[model samples]
Target: MKQRYHVLLCLLGVIGCLLFFPRDLSSALTFTPQALYDLTASRTGQAAAKPVPFVSSGFAGFLDENGRPQYVEKIRYGAAVSSMGIINYDSVSTKLVMRNRDGEIQVAIETRGYPFFLKERLLIISTDRLRLKEYTTDGDLLWSATFPSPVTACAAAGNRFLIGLLNGNFLYLNEAGEPLYSFTPPEGRIKVAYGAAMDAASEASLVVAGIDPQTAYLLEERNGELNSIESFPLGSDLRRNLLVSSLHGGRFAIEQEQGLLVVDRTNLRRRYFSIPGRLLSVQGHPESNLLSALSQDDSDRFVSMIGSESNYRGRLRLAGYGPGTSILWSGNRFIILVDGHVLVYRLELI
Candidate 1:
């Protein structure tokens, strides 16, 4: 009788724990935030007042107004300009080349017409009404693919890119610029692709988030096909600016005006956390729903730790510092570009 009573008590305890903590308790790991050096503050020169395009690798970078990699590891700027700086453009097309301090042609893309974006080392050259082209950091032509109809939106990352078309359909392409998957919404449900993200290997799932008439659509790419399309109702005009970003291995983040919506690969599990003010950007944590976001206040931006049990944990250590910043990478250490500075910080959240 005593042994049976003990077993019953242990079973009751387990039930109580699960009822209180329903989520995956194992996800609540300790995450700490650490600060590193600043780019402009550590360098000697001032950047051109104009906003210049910048991109960073692990330690080096090509800041605005210059086509050379500054050895951020050594804290030295303009110290090692590379000889590959001179780009020989094709006579038939108008092209621009980005040369790093290492003299390597980090990017050589022709964006004479339509929209052009230089991300990391890949050059995204697009013709809004037609096709898109991509180039490698070494000026190598990766691939060029065209669409069936007019494209309304487009985004790229890691190993793939996506384009939203006029017919309420979206096309996804690999790093080689080959079209891999296409998804079309139900007839008359048109949403432009405003943001997109995929796992590092592009093997888990691709998230394409967008808006049309205040309705947001979410598409999931899986197993060489697209399925599990979800449409979210909008609360305000913020739905017009729904932005999507990769969260983790099989999750993604969507930034609406009120807060953020995070979804797993299956498209069944999801969560939304309301934010206080206008969010400028959000960097998702590598392991949890917890994230770091930049919120705007009177034209100045501050960092906020979000999605904690408190909903709003607190301000980040480097809050309200960089304007027009971008989170370069997310993992144990997060690198971001604020103004002309590339800052690195250690991140930990529980």
Candidate 2:
């Protein structure tokens, strides 16, 4: 009788430890806002003076005074430049490139793709194919590749890369473009390629999150195999018009009818923040630990900078953030960060 009673007590102790210890322990692993903010701020500061203007002329894809496309010239440096729907910026060489449906490349000098330090390489994808390119600081292509199928979207985690396809397929690759593993979705109508990122909390893990037709999927990859899949329903309103803007590193950002959704790969948890009006554009700042949203207001536009739980709204201006949500800087003319210095410009739009 005494031994039975002691065994019961030990079982109860194990249960208590499981319930309480992991919760508190996980909380301690999270980032502290002060520490992140200080690390970011130390690397960013206001520029001594306004940026020197890099001017151009022409509109509607026409050339400017210096014989450059108006759009390209305007965003030559720190712009959120997108082409063929893929967005990326390089700070070392100070260039931004976008791919268009026609397979044309747009290069700009000043740009809105700020917090410029995050993107070290370029990612390009399409419905029937995929490509990875290395670049020099002067807009020179270092190397490029064409993958197997029509790639819908892509994300990079450290030295690993994740690519999602229109046929509900995905491939994991090393930095050198060697195949590690592949996965297929359970459903066929999963035409849209939502988002993907590396799972930092787990070793050799990748998270592919997206809306497949009317359902949302969180697919987990470990040891070159997809072992678990979690599904969530976003209801009619959000499900009907789901759009995913960006996924890189271990972060995923999605835009649905309800608002913007951000998820961390490590925790398998998510957070939603409402937009004041309809969203025009959304992008993730990997290094700065912030997400940017642009909305149309009358003739002008407004940009909102949102951190994990806090919100700050500003007018249609240029801006950038440092890694891990550490620093935020903006300006009226142009916002460009070169070697940790913020450069704002006054333009003479010709």
Candidate 3:
């Protein structure tokens, strides 16, 4: 009888101890965010500072055949509609120029969303019409094609090109400008595409998306045909914002309120991250989900490095990022556009 009474007391005491000292569910879990950039590190750059020297203010930049970045500004004839262009860089020896029989061709090329570069070819796509001209680095016109609707954006691989149209039409063409596959988006869905990304590894197939609640479509190139592999819905959260393309590889990013909505192009694997400030613009890795986000923290500006899994890694406070200030990520370099100066920083993860 005494032993039974003692056992009961010990059990009651143990139950009371458990009730008083509960375990935390989350505290036992282990996870570490990717990285944080070293605060003391800074990058260097060059100044493209010079006079506008042109009648019109159409300035753009592109990578050369040798993988060097070159800037082009439109040079205009005095009060005429003719558009001349000059390569405004210190190293003018490797500069490629475009000229026509009468004068300069009236076309300027720039990426509408992402900084996609082709190693060998440059596409001169008309912003106002349904035309595309492929040019070699030496300024040779290789091929040109006209579409049924106005071309919205263009993405290119080696000899393959994917063209998005304003009418929700997608045309997949070869190096010779022959139409391989044509796709029209769903009847009730968004047909007018905002951006396009071509995955060179996926047989030069493409992923395209637009604004109606933001859905992505993976168009696979199979047996010389374009097939709609999947249509991944991005939900209603991405509605009505200015949808731009930031697709690199298996992932694509969309601009959101204070961060980026990065998703896997194949599986719709969503990763949304919020930087600690109002997002101004974003650039990221073309192969991974590493994003260089530029945001305004009150009156100051800062750049934060987001990881592949959408974790806040590190941040760098920018000195003079303001209105009309632009930034570009060239894989290993961060190019900041400050008026006439181009600040280039070798991206280091610290």
Comparing candidate 1 with candidate 2, which one achieves the higher TM-score? 1
Clashes in model 3: which pairs?
37-314, 45-344, 75-84, 168-191
Per-residue error at 227 for model 3, in Å? 2.7
Q: Write the per-residue lDDT of candidate 2 for residues 128-220, one digit (tens) a residue.
A: 355555444445544455665556556655666667765556676766777777766554244444445444433333333334344455656
lDDT of 3 at 297: 61
Q: Estimate the lDDT of model 2.
A: 0.42
lDDT at 87, model 3: 30
TM-score, one value per model: 0.62, 0.47, 0.59
Q: CA lDDT of each candidate? A: 0.51, 0.42, 0.51
Residues 78-165, model 3: lDDT tens digits: 1111112333222212223443212344333332211123433555444456777765534556787888888776776666777777
Residue 50 shift from truth in candidate 3, angstroms: 23
Candidate 2 regions with alpha-carbon error over 4 angstroms: 1-118, 123-145, 188-190, 198-212, 219-229, 235-251, 277-291, 297-300, 305-350
* Model 2 per-residue lDDT at 112: 24
RMSD in Å for model 3: 18.0
Report how far residue 159 has shifted in candidate 1, in Å.
6.0
